[model samples]
Target: MKDRGHVSTTQTLDLNDAGKIIDAGIAEAERIGNPSNIAGVDAGGCLLAFARMDDAWRGSVDIAISKAWTARAFDVETKALAKLAQPGADFYGIHASNDGKVMIFAGGVPIKEGETVIGAVGVSGGTGKQDQGVAEAAAQAFARG
Candidate 1:
């Protein structure tokens, strides 16, 4: 029997937290002089918040969201997945799975709490390094807060 005094439920990332992450990502993008599309996803890989900087590539919108979804879906950084998805690697051809939603590249970062992934952030519309930097900044800011 459940304890009446203790309510139990799985923790999930909320929109307020997601907004903070997105703001951090946007700030990083601006610092780097790169307009970008940023996306945040909940633990269940659902979109919680997003932002598109002015002059950002329109095509990157979907890419950013997919990157966030891919991160939360696999609980792995998309950049790391890129390496594994390389030719002849274990995850090779994985990009072809998930209905092409898997983005095996930089810019996706999973936010975790004690080994459990709570959510993720993704950025696009710049070089892989730039996107990675923004995503990392967002995750780091969240961790610090």
Candidate 2:
């Protein structure tokens, strides 16, 4: 144990920050007139906080969480994946290869602290653009606070 190499490190979100992200997402969803399902996840793609607005679709729960997880895991918005997964692209057929966990839709945004991506938030239960906007609002809230 005398010759230790460099150690790796990463930032992760705690419950407080995750809750903030969720709250902001909820507010955004309400403002947009589209009650949504929202989720927050740490750097390792573990769910930290979640919110399902009243009358939200029951099926959107998993999709929202998966959007956050996928964003954190890949450091890319879920919707952007759609472009990369198109036919003849490098990630073509990637959708079916991930056990159906991947969500290539607009509803995920990374939570960054400075240049480091600490976690992510995802939103669903509305149009893709609406979902993406809500997620972005959540991320901005986390950044500001």
Candidate 3:
């Protein structure tokens, strides 16, 4: 028998990790004094976990989840997709074509470890920049762990 070197693999986010991401997002929202809704989803666009602040807008829950779904499904930030809707772009209808799962707006970011996409986190119920900030904070939290 020949000896073989050890193989290494990258870490990926599963359902439990996705839940942690959602928690981090909620915490970020609180820290920023922006009560909002947050959601996490797996790479396949399946919902892993979600949270809505006590005073968050009722509709933000659905929007946050949809944002996460969109990011996971596309493997990119929803904001980037939103940018593709420029006047001459061919994807102008993409935002409305995902059957309500695609929210082509800021606030959704994919959770990636190197090239491996684990899942995504999304925040809503604030300005676009505020939402993006919350999502970024959550992503940073997940990366730290």
The 0-to-1 C-alpha lDDT of every candidate, in the order given, reads: 0.93, 0.89, 0.84
lDDT agreement of model 2 with the native: 0.89
Q: Which ten residues in a row have the lowest lDDT in candidate 1?
A: 2-11
lDDT of 1 by residue, 51-75 (tens): 9999999999999999999999999
Name model 3 segments beyond 4 Å from true. Answer: 1-12
- CA lDDT of 100 in candidate 2? 80
lDDT of 3 by residue, 1-145 (tens): 6657576554546777877777787887888888989888876777888888899999888899998888878888888888886667867878667676779889899999878887889889899988998898888888888
Query: Which scores greater on lDDT, model 2 or model 3?
Result: 2
Best by TM-score, which number?
1
CA displacement after TM-score superposition, residue 128 of candidate 3 (Å): 0.5
Better of 1 and 3 by TM-score: 1
TM-score (C-alpha) between model 1 and the true structure: 0.93
Cα miss at 5, model 1 (Å)?
12
RMSD of each: 2.2, 2.1, 3.9
Q: Model 2, which residues run further than 4 Å from truth? A: 1-5
Top-lDDT structure, candidate number: 1
